[model samples]
Target: MAKTRTDLINQVLDRLNILVYGQSPSLEDVQRADRIVDGAIAKLASLDIYYVQDPGQAGPSGGAIEDEAFLPLADYIASFHLLADARTQALAQIAEAELRTIAAPARTLRTLRVDPALTPRRYGYYRGGI
Candidate 1:
C-alpha cells in the first residue's frame, strides 16, 4: 500500500535531521537555518561585485529597476537553499492552524521569500553561494 502524505513528510523531515540528530526539533535546528539564511542575505549585499565583470565596466542595465532590484535579489539569493517561505516561517504555526484540521502536513516545502521578484523561478537559484 502507498504511504500517505503524513508518512512522506515524516520521512523527509526524518531524513533531513540526520545532520540534525533525527528530527525532534530543537531551538538549535531552527535557529541555525535562520542564521545561515540571514548570512546569505548579507552576502548578497556584495553581489554588485559579481555583476561587475570588468574593473571599470558598467553592469547589467535596466535603469531605475536595477537599483530597485537589490533587496528582492538579496532575498532571492538567501532563499535559494532555504526552507520555508517568509509567509509561513514556522511549521509549528501551520500545525496549530491549517494542519490542525488536516491529519497531515507538508514538510518538503519550497523555500520562502517575500517580494514577487524573489521567487525561485525569477532569479534562478545558485545552489551554493554564487
Candidate 2:
C-alpha cells in the first residue's frame, strides 16, 4: 500500500510534537496539516527529487501506505541518523538537501547517457555501425 498525504503530515506533526502522543488530531488540525504536507510535496516535486505513488488521489486516513519505489526513499529521508545530525536544521531544509543529494547524481547520469554531445567516447567498433 502506498503512503498517503495524511501519513506524511502526521509524521511531520508528530516529529514537531504538534500532535501529542496518544492524542488524536482534531479535524481542523488534520486539514491544516494536510495542506502543509501538500505544500511540502509540491516543493519537492518541483525539483523532481521526490518520487511517490498516487500523490493526489484520495485514500483511507493517513493516506495509503507507501509503495516500494517510494518506501526506500522515504526511509532514507526519515532516518534517525540524518535527522539527528541535522537536529538544528529545519526538516524542510534537511529534506531538500537530502532529496537533491539522492536525485542530482541520477539526473546527471541520465543527462550524460541521453545527450550525445555529453556522452563519453567508446573504444570498441561494432559489426553494424549503422
TM-score of each: 0.21, 0.52
lDDT of each: 0.35, 0.52
1-130 per-residue lDDT for model 2 (tens digits) = 5666666655655665556788877776556555554544565677687654455543325445445434333333333322333542455465566666655554444532477777889899678956
lDDT of 2: 0.52
lDDT, model 1: 0.35
lDDT tens digits by residue: candidate 1, 1-130: 3332222222233334323554464445434443443343344335322231111111211212133233233233333334645543343233233322332346778886699676567566678964
Model 1 RMSD, rounded to 1 decimal? 25.3
Error of 2 at 74 (Å): 9.1
RMSD of each: 25.3, 10.1
| lDDT at position 11, candidate 1 | 29
Q: Per-residue error at 65 for model 1, in Å? A: 18
How far is 104's C-alpha from truth in model 2 (Å)?
A: 4.2
